[model samples]
Target chain A: MRDVYIIGAGIHPFGRHDLSGLEQGVAAARDALKDAGADWQDMQFAFGGSLAAGNADAMLPIMGLSTMQFINVANGCATGGSALLSGYWSIKSEEFDMGIVVGFDKHPRGAFNADPKASGLPQWYGDQGLMLTTQFFGMKIQRYKELYGISDETLGKVAEKAFQNGSLTPHAWRREPVDLDTIMNSQMVSDPLTKFMFCSPAEGGAALILASEEKMKQLGAKGVLMRGASVRTRPQGSFEVFSPSLDVERGGTPTEVASKAVYEMAGIGPEEIDIAQIQDTESGAEIMHMSENGFCADGDQEKLIQDGDTKIGGKLPINTDGGCLACGEPIGASGLRQVYENVIQLRGDAGDRQVPGNPRLGYTQVYGAPGLSACTILSAA
Target chain B: MAELLDKEEILKLEPLAEGLFRLDNGVPVLLGGKNKETGKIVFPMPSGAEAERFDVVPLKRTGKLWSWTVQRFRPKTPPYRGPGDDKNFQPYAVGYVELEDQVIVETRIMGDPDQTLKIGMEMELALEPFELGDEDKYVSTFAFKPVA
Candidate 1:
């Protein structure tokens, strides 16, 4: 209903951290407030979440005891985006002038193990080892490769680029370039997907300060306009993680639905997006999401990746901060990290990984288990 | 009907879970749920409160391989009851098999993952023995083997 802008953004470096998840959240929130030239008292309301970490509202005592409405969100990997959108709606409705959206998580090292019973699935599904997320990625990509003629070399190239970009990103966990051969030859976690192509469960935090246009001008803060934000869950019959069965008739994925909605709300097409950060939970996810998000055709990624067109200083720089591949997925914090990277890219402050040619429009998409996707479109103010 | 009843005997081996499959005329058939009103089918059937909404039906034993991959690493315990550690864990193939016009079911593929599995290949349901983390005890779990 009203215009919202991101006045500031901050992130605690994504990887293993000594600080607790809540502490990391506080740090990122403090950094964002400082960057916005605002204090804790300035936030009228807040929204935040974490997966393995404790309650987000717990940051209140550590920061300052305020009566601000701090709603805790838990939407799988879309936690950060959901928090940001909640803050955006609060401002858009004229209910709050400014607020904070933060996300943090610290997961134990290893592939995430979810309880099948919790998800209402049969226990035998888990007992039989059919509940793995990695296997789902492998199967999905294996099928995509068959139908679209995607080469294993292209999948390897995606990881190679992620590491190359991560080497340039200070906040990235895997900050060294790994060659394509190494990526292709790495221990096969799942067939066609090697260890190097996957993102491990890790820890980190990120935050964003959202304000109405009135507050931004009053504070003299340079803002990034939040043109659109949308989150969608899987429709019936769509393939997703942790499913023991699939429908006979296929349906659209949440990413496709959310991406379409956000672009429509932003009043722009994928071609106009200068910089983009879609979910790269794994190499194949990045490859599939490229087409799902309407950026390119189903098989176009083969050439787009081979020619390095998706690299920095290319046609469209994607995941300039290395995405989940190098950052490691921290669940709650992962989605907001994408936005934080876009903010820095838009401000032209991303030192080495910056997309050249004065990028204007930036887009981000985060997707996770049980078929959920959240998307945002931001433009330089 | 009497001959059909004589052939319709539940396999003697213990299944990983009940109501997953039974033998039909000496052939393994998956038990699926068919929505009483909509005719939509689902694998493993529904249990508990949801069970009342659908009718138990035997699904086709043969299907086409939709997609597949090899589990090269040991999954975490508790959720995974298979016997093995990092050193001795055997890599197994898993994939979705499309059962004609019915539901596509996810199942373990019994074969050499690198050499035998191919997309769109015909597969038939069979019961595979899964170790239950104890010595000499096994349970039958449904899997799809390449159709010769």
Candidate 2:
């Protein structure tokens, strides 16, 4: 029940990196510690998230810190969020006063080659061409469009916003703003979605420093209160990947369940959130997630985009530092990158893409493969 | 029948029904379990370990298309065992078929990818053959085809 606050956050940008995954982790971790004016010895615990690396905790050696409890976490795209949660719980339970959470990844090219057997899924599932994550996003949004009358232009607008924001961001991968027509004219990756709308596999690292309220006061550092942190999986009957068949009368998706839990724990509804960083593996994902995260109605994304409500300097600026759409999706670092952006926005450090108002409350949600979702609420202290 | 033919010969692989579909009077019908307590239905219901009280029942043969997407490109290897090389891979439609509001089966849509597939259109299950490897190795899979 103790309070947790994020004292510092850092990122190694989102794009191809020549350094190894652990190297990237070490870089981000070092920056985070420096930003907090703390040393490696101050960290009582550490959690690392990475998909392509051997073990994120291995970065401990590089930091010259040892004998500390370090756990490596991997939950697909939720890796970063899960790591942050682990660090938060470590402090919340009074088990540790302060900790570091780092997520980094170095991925290969082309569509992610997921292993069904490795993930405990039947070989037949992939053999029948059912395990591709791209197909899942495409199908999910296709259904959303059918039920809600969303159009390709609306989806294109989402990508355009992300790229435009990325262009202004210092560390974004795709820094050039793409035109709406260019996004729409891009080659088809799936029906209703073009190649330009999909996020590419990326290489990057992001890290956060979480400490108790007492510890922050000791350091005399300003920080953001970690009001809520939650992670949830799909309940039965929800339309999720790896689900061969769905119960028509099933339960809620991980995003819905996790968002609700996070809001309840934070003691704030979606209306209080001034900025957001959500999962946008593809353009349509942003559109669908806008509703899933309770930001808007189920079918109101077209208006949300057209009115520029979800853009920077608008009603609710989402992914102001560019999302996975513009940053590229480095599975492990993706979630923490969202938090890093929130921290920057809350601190009023984001120069170009800062929301017009002095945003006080921010929220982040990350959805992973095989149905796992996590969200965290941050408020300026 | 197990002792009768060459391994390379084409064979009707067991349907991917997992006891959910059967050839009843030469017609394929989906099967499911209706929970006695909750009245909830599940297709290809769990066997033995969790089937203490539910009855295995036959599901409706046809339903409407709920949602769909097309695989515009070939998926990666080590998992995808579809026919042909990536260069020759043809786009295919994938969708969910709602079976009488009881269950929605995720299935491959058997139709031309260029054709427009509207939601709420009637669809029926069809057992189809999927060739694997260079030889005659094949597997029988199930897909939902639009019903006239």
Candidate 3:
């Protein structure tokens, strides 16, 4: 296998947008190519994904009719991570010297409504109003809090920090800082979780240009080394979304599996990671993923958040760009947004929200429905 | 038994979906599927061609609340056939009830919204009116309530 580097990254601001999903995607792609000091024809291949947008390969006509392999990826919230991974593999395997990986999505306002029959679940599950993603997150955290003794205040703090960071992020959707009291007092969407703690379904696009070491040097472009990337699915007995039944015996989560594999692939432990961006679909998810990703022990988030350890300039900064909570989840684009934020952070170009002290290593994790998780590790080159 | 049927008839009762629950000696019992090879049990027993590989079995009526949440707003329709508007919709508790030595079934918890429910509390299966069906009958779905 060969080394892959991210020469450039770009993102269309996340939130409601007038442009179509494909147009947003193309804009990001063009910016990425420009940032890399390369042109559209320079990409030897492309990989992209979108949940609500049309096929990614369809961008060929709009992006100059270049005949390059463009594979479409669709892996729930891991769409962007998977696309990046595909591009990484193409370069690692020497199949392609350089390529573009992009993701974009525009969902209608409101909670995403899924078809039970399409997911192979009984229709009654949906009819009885039991098939909801919010309810699943609520129950999962409710149980975790009971077992781990996590406090409601800790949950509120997570959202408060997200908004605080979002205030500094130009690309973030929720740019205003929210107080802890306000977050805790917001309308209850599900028991123990309020409206302010949840990320709304919104629009956006992000793209990354990956190249081999040879290609990067040839273009005289600075780059970030793609150390590792891994995607894992739920194992049997693991609790996941949209389940009508759960096994009596609990099992490991996909985040745990993917995190473990990614650390091994990157040849580093979580402690060495200077800046991190794990999935924060809600406050509880960030708390849970903190332990799942091997950053901290279960129930330790309370102390970490209270001590401001996870905040910018702290020991281990997380979601310096506000994560899903502030950005609003665009499904396909959300994962790549993490990488884009990390790239800027690594380059020391994240204007106001930059993590103080030169950070060398950055990590990102994205998780979604049916219990899937994707993790990536990047290092400044 | 007759009183139960009278109450059902007054509401124009119908199961939300066929074969989910049935009356056994005047008591409603939820049906589950027991895998022939693995002995793994699943709720609402598999239907159609998939049903061929498992034996239909009655699930335990009593269990303990594993985890729960409340639906504070109306879910989107097409999948959700319940009350569409906020005026007609009432917040309801949803939970996973762990049946000892069997599967943990996701279910609606029948109770007052203001009443707080504790984890590991004993719960028992019951039938609740879900929504109005096409035939003017009230569709009944299975739910769990705190055991008296």
Candidate 4:
């Protein structure tokens, strides 16, 4: 099988814009093309990722760019990462030399967006309640803090450091520095989780171009060959409807399952990872992710983050881009955004946010819709 | 969306088995009536691992405030017309109750239509109906009451 690597990564500043989803897709795709210094004309196939917009790929690419045909795919929050997985499968099969995956999202208009998994009737008909996505995680957050005694400050530490780093990055959704007090004082969304502990909804786009080893040599692909690209759904046997146990239900807890598979597939272990990007829609999800993915044992994550172990200079740099908590949560684009950060870290182009010394393996976790989860592993090694 | 029917006439708020409808693994299901329009919560069923008995009382007590909403405008469907001249029940209140055993239940609240409900409130189940009706084929339903 021909080795595949991400040759170019691109994304639009993930914030609200007047442009439509299709326009965002085009802009993001162009950014990837520019980063790779390759023309869209050279593309063999494409996978356009968008969560809500209908049939977005057909309208994104510049017309007559090698007449390259593209396929559209969506996996809810995992849309972009799953798109990356699909692109990898096709490229490694030698059907396509290069593929591009792009995802775009803007928060819903009017009433809070309804959760499709709610099992209840339509919001227009049933009193489903106004569920702020981040706040909806309130139940689990309350339990986790109670179980672990993780102070609000430890959660804030990530916010204080991450958003500051995001502020420096041109593409981050939130660019403001936040202190622990600021985070604690933020409006209460759910018990124990204030507004700052939640990710703000924003508009953004993320695009990545992947090429097979054969194509990379032809295009002079530099740095960070795709050591591992994996996207997975929760095990069918394990998937359940409305598990009352808060621990089992939050964001699908797939980091454990995915990490086990990814490590075996990437031939790497958690200890080998220099940097990791966890999906932290709410501050609590971040810590739970640390435990579920074997980054730390239960309750140990508090010490890990409070002691600065997950920070850039700590034992492992997690969410060097401030996470969704500090960064905006642009649903469709958020998953790919994780990949974008990993790419930048592996490429050593993370600027001031870059970790000390050259890092090697990077892990990205995208857990969502309460149980739909996927993890991608990238290595510059 | 069905019409907001006379919930009292349609639902029979009887205990399915007087807390007998327990999970095979010994988990008990809470049953009761929560006023869909009044936002009142009532628990009418027994919970927890209790032995079968005559005149049985409930053993379970904890529940999570799952989700909630005030009845905005008239309900989409039902025989529910508020106590006004207009036929449309323009505003009411209602939501779901998730108990400790992870049972999601429906309930109603008595409040101004403009009042908002916070998710995860400490709500207990109650026996009541959002819509009242005269003597007919009387059916019953459950409701919820906010625990102080």
Q: What TM-score does chain B alone reach in each candidate, compared with the true chain B?
A: 0.88, 0.78, 0.87, 0.45
Shift in Å, residue A377, candidate 4: 0.8
Residue-level lDDT tens digits of model 3 in A1-381: 999999999899999999999998998898889889988898999999999998888789999888988899998889999999899999999989999999999999989997998889988898878889999999999999999989999999999999999999999999999999999999999888999999999999999999999999999999999899999999888889999999888789999999999999999999999999999999999999999999999989889999999999999999999999999999889999999999999999999999999899999999998789999999987
Let me know the TM-score candidate 1 reaches against the reference structure.
0.97
Question: Count of backbone clashes for each model?
Answer: 0, 0, 0, 51
Show model 1 residue runs off by greater than 4 Å: B1-11, B134-136
Of 3 and 4, the candidate ranking higher by DockQ? 3
> Which stretches in model 2 have alpha-carbon errors above 4 Å?
B1-21, B31-40, B45-57, B134-138
- Model 2 chain A, poorest ten-residue lDDT window? A116-125
Per-residue alpha-carbon lDDT of candidate 1 for residues A129-207, written as tens digits (9 for 90 to 100): 8889999999999999999989999999999999999999988999999999999999999988999999999999999
Q: Rank the candidates by DockQ, best first.
A: 3, 1, 2, 4
lDDT by residue for model 4 (A259-294), tens: 787778788778888898888877878887888777
TM-score of chain A of each: 0.99, 0.97, 0.99, 0.90
Scored by lDDT, model 1 comes in at 0.91
Candidate 2, residues B1-148, lDDT tens digits: the string is: 2223332331246654366567666566767777889888775555675777778888787998888889988877668777778788888899888898588877888768878798899999876666664344665666788897
Estimate TM-scores for all models. Answer: 0.97, 0.92, 0.97, 0.74
Query: Candidate 1, clashing residue pairs?
Result: none
lDDT of 3: 0.91
RMSD of each: 3.5, 3.7, 2.0, 9.2
